[model samples]
Target: MQTSSNTRCCIVGGGPAGMMLGLLLARAGVAVTVLEKHGDFLRDFRGDTVHPSTLDILSELGLKKRFDALPQHRVTGIEGLFADGIHALGDFRGLKPFPYMALVPQWDLLTLLADEAERYPNFTLRMRCEATELIRREDTGRVAGVITHTPEGPLHIGADLVIGCDGRHSRLRNAAGLRPRDLGSPMDVLWFRLPRHATDPDGTYGVPGRGTLLVLLNRTDYWQIACVIPKGGAAQLRERPIAEFQARIARRVDFLGDRVNSIASWDDIKLLEVRVDRLPQWHCPGLLLIGDAAHAMSPIGGVGINLAIQDAVAAANLLAPVLLAPGLPDEATLAAVQQRRLLPTKIIQAIQIFLQRRIIARVLAAHDDGKLVALPGAARFLLRFRLIRSIPARVFGVGFRREHIDSP
Candidate 1:
């Protein structure tokens, strides 16, 4: 394994969170290396909805044009449909510039960010490199760097700071003895891609009354669908035939029956257990946790990526002073980052859990007739009310401003 002469920051994981943080820091002229286990950016059907607040961040970075050039579908808003033909649609058009979310494939998003990050001279992207263990300074019990498994052999790289964006199962978090507190309702998602028929609109495929199924219609005749199911229900579905899976989905959302010509194979359906978890502390000494490593959000509200980007912004903003300073990050600077982000993270996590339990799951289980009538009224109120949506956006997007970071 080769080592760089001057490594300032070591970022683990090349997902959205890692890539975004790398880009932000690289643009700031910091020496950053992103180590990712995956060799390529092409992945299937990952989270794709880019929220309004995230769009605002992209615009701020002047990367909005690059993102817009990608194959994306503009979603004006989100809608909740009940089984009874009732629906609540939340129109995001009230926001400036672009009112809607953009449905771009996660692979495209990561590739785009990685490409932008490469434009910086100090940025290095290392693929197929896995972070194996956390290295610590023996005298002070402070994290010094990480030991990674490279193509040739195990390499130990020291850095001024180690940022853990390795996701929920973070080795860095575990090495730091940080335990995440679970705050999400138990649920799982069965994700699959099916051919989108000619009849399907070039928009979101939402049920009027139920909230279990989330469908995104892509450019071609292809639609990505994520259906919420019981935590361990994946195995049972895997045992059933593809036809059984199609029938089950049809029963959940009737519109799929009309738009879907055929159900993809069961193997094509990916199952992920959803959970929300947050660490007690975001940093300890020279190590820090961001994205899923710090706070894991439920996929119910489609805010995971947006929140991750927000974490990157907060980290970059807070660490800017330290990066440009004469010394490493002090306890106060680290604490400031955590302090600045804690409340907003907590609030957004609460909202995601509430939406899943109170809204999504409730609508999914309700009878068809009960869902239809209940959704429209709820949707209209939320769409028209600026306070309801904007408050959460502020919490999840910009975070507490720099001035408010030290405030109580």
Candidate 2:
């Protein structure tokens, strides 16, 4: 399946990473093609956190005014319900220009990026096209292009580089024979939305008590709920009737009243298999992997999307100039992309892993006999000082390594 079609870059996934990289390269006057498996970006239960770091990138590009106009909910901080009372663990008020996280649907963000990228003549996005396999030049053994299944039929896209932004369960990553170094995650999240009225809570809420932990994120019209459960406890939970869940919700959030019944059937719930992992090496010769394709983060702080986006920004800054040159990027250049982003990826993943084992897992593992315990040393320290709480805000809001918009 070879079509004489060629571009400067072929991005396998039109997700945050792919679409973003596509827009950056095209904006820099390099031809770029992005392939998305889905016909549209209207998918449910996707990551919706648009952190300050991501917003900073848009602001640097002079798109802040336009982006702020989009429909979004502002999250100023994250609160957890402890024995004493609700304590603030994340605060974004101290951050600069954009001091809060924007709770916008992932699809809307993708659509916005596509709209902005289309303005560039060199940007091409092929919806409903799926990458099936990678094509390696037999003589050099370096990836030259990708074979995709298009509406017409099989189509071959030849490019100087192929980036796998495909995702955690990436077919491209699998095809490339890359193995993920699992950092381990002890819990998974069940996602479902409950209608929000004018009287609902103001911001995010964490109800932790009696062997249950639930996180509710305000989404303006509705609340995106994350019911955290043991790694493989969903099956056991299903043994009980839906009424049990309704009862549990009522006990946890007294304010919700009877609204918990809105989740009448199990079909309304979607389970997100949380994964904490990263590939040891992100690239091989002419190929590169960014976003979830390179590292999969837990939904603890809703920082996965931001991490992936930063990877795209860094990748574009590094590879765009070289793409405009005669020959494709060599192995050294691809390694440099991974080298610059690897430390940041490890730093964030390490924090997530620590929280999962040190806090979340302990919360789930505890047998609640209705006895309230004092906060752990670390959590108590976080609550005792306002500045200490700000640490998490800075970590989740702006991220570890701040990548500038150098490609622009």
The candidate that achieves the highest TM-score relative to the unseen native structure: 2
User: How much is the lDDT of residue 312 in candidate 2?
Assistant: 91
Q: Per-residue CA lDDT of candidate 1, range 1-408, in tens?
A: 365333788999988889988988888878888999888978776678787777877777778998999988887655445544433245565666667778888999899889988998989998988888888889998887888887887778788889999988898898889999988665688777766767755556455334345544454557777776656667876887777667656665565676344655776678778878998888899988988999888875577787777778788877866776667877788778778778877877877787777766775565543123334565556655766645443444333431211110
**For residues 274-340, what per-residue lDDT tens digits would candidate 2 score against the true structure?**
9999999988878999999999999988898999999999999999889988887998888989999
Off by over 4 Å in 1: 1-6, 81-88, 208-220, 258-261, 361-408
Clashes by residue pair, model 2: none
CA shift at 369, candidate 1, in angstroms?
12
Q: Provide the RMSD of all predictions against the true structure, rounded to 1 decimal.
A: 3.8, 1.9
Number of the top-ranking candidate, with lDDT as the measure: 2
Worst 10 residues of 2 by lDDT: 368-377
